[model samples]
Target: MESETKQSVYHSATYHAAGEAIMSFKPINEIHQHLCAFHVYSSDHSRHVEAHHYCKHLSKDFHQCVIYDSDDPNARLIGIEYIVSEKIFKSLPPEEKKFWHSHKYEVESGLLQLAPKSLVPGAATDIAEQPAMLELHQTYGKTIHTWAIDVYPDLPLGPPNLMMSYIGDGQGPPAEMVQARDAASGQDTAAKRELRKGYLSSYERVEAADEWAKTGRGVEFVVKEVPLKK
Candidate 1:
C-alpha cells in the first residue's frame, strides 16, 4: 500500500508534468552540456566531492551549472557553480575574487572533462572536444555546496561552504579518489593529462582568482548578530 506522503508526491509530480507540458523553460531548455569534476573546500582540500554539472551556457562570457553528486535519477542537487570568462573574473572586486577559483589547473591536469553522452555511465566513444577545453581552461568558477554530504550525510545542515579547485601539482585530489572517479565516469585521467600537455599552458592566470591557493586565505560564512530589516 502506498503511504499518504507517497500518494501526494505522485499527484504533485503529475501536476508538475502537466504544467511542464505547456510551459517553455527557456533557461532549462538552454542547458546543453554536462561535465564532471572534483571540488574541495577552500578551507580543507583533503575533503572532496564529485561534482556532476548540468550546465546552461548563458553567453560566451558566462555559464552556470546545477551540480549533483551523481547522474543517478535520485541524485541530490548538491549546489551550483557559476563559471565566467577571464575578463569577467578580472572585473570582480578584490573581496569578491576570493570566492572564485581558477580552472586552468583543473583543465590542464585533466581532472575536469565533459560527461559521457550516452545513458551508460562508463561507455566509450564519448570524447571531450578541444573547443570545450579551450573555453573552460581560462574561466573561473564560484561554487558553493549547500548540502554537506561529506559531513552530515542525511541532512543539508550548517551554512553553505565555498568550494575550490586544486591549482597546482601535488595538490590534486587523492589518488584513490581519482581512481574512483575514473571508474565511474570511464575517464582516463592519466591519458587525458598526457593528451592535454602544452594545451593552454601559455594562458596567463588571473591572479585575483583562487585566492585560497594563492595566499592561503579563503572565505567562510558564520551567523552573526544583526537586527532584522523591517
Candidate 2:
C-alpha cells in the first residue's frame, strides 16, 4: 500500500507539470562577460586578495563586476566591484562619491592585471598599452570584499571589509607576491610598466575612499583608549 501511494504521487499530474515547466525554462547565460583578474588590498592596506572579475556592462558609462576568489573550480565568491565613468562619478552625491576609489595608479603601475589564463606572455603588456585601457584609467570603482580569505584562509571570518584600489606609488601588493603571480600566469609586469609610460598622462588621479577616513567625512573612525597593565 505504501509503495502504491508513492508511485501515485510520482505519476501525479502536478508533478509531471512541474517537471515540464522546469525543462521548458531556458537559463539566461549571456549577460556575464569574464573580464580579468585584479590583486586588491584592504582599505587599511593590511591584507591582499586576488579577485577575478566577471563583468556585466550595464551601459556605456557603467559596469558591475562580480569578483571571485579565483577562477578555479573550487573558487569562492569574494566580493563585487562597481566601475563607473567620470561622468557618472561626478553625478553622484558628495557622500556617495566618498565610497569609490580612482583607477589611476592601478592602471599606470600595472597592478590591476588581466587574467593570464586568457593571455600569452607579453600579451598583457600589449593590451595595457591600448587606448581602451585609458578609459579605465579615468574610471572609479567601489568594491566590498565579503570574504577575508587572506587573513582567514580556512574560512571567511568577521564582518565584510570595504576594499580600496591602490592609489600611491608602491602602495599595491608586495613585489614578491606580484612576481610570483606573474611567473605562474606568464605575465611580465616589469615590461608592462615600461610600455605604459606614455599612457600615464591619460590617468586622472582622483580622491580615494581611504582619504575619507582621514577627514571624518563619509565613514567615521572612533578610537578607544585602552589601559596597559603590567
lDDT of 2 by residue, 8-83 (tens): 9878968879888787433224335444445455445656777777776788789888788777867888888899
lDDT of 1 at 218: 64
How well is each residue in 5-93 modelled by candidate 1, as lDDT tens digits?
89999999999999999999988778888888999987787788989999998899999899998889889989999999998998988
Count of backbone collisions within predicted model 1: 0
What TM value does model 1 have?
0.87
Each candidate: how many clashes? 0, 0
Off by over 4 Å in 2: 1-28, 31-43, 128-132, 199-201, 208-230
- Top candidate on lDDT is 1
Q: List the residue pairs that clash in candidate 1.
A: none
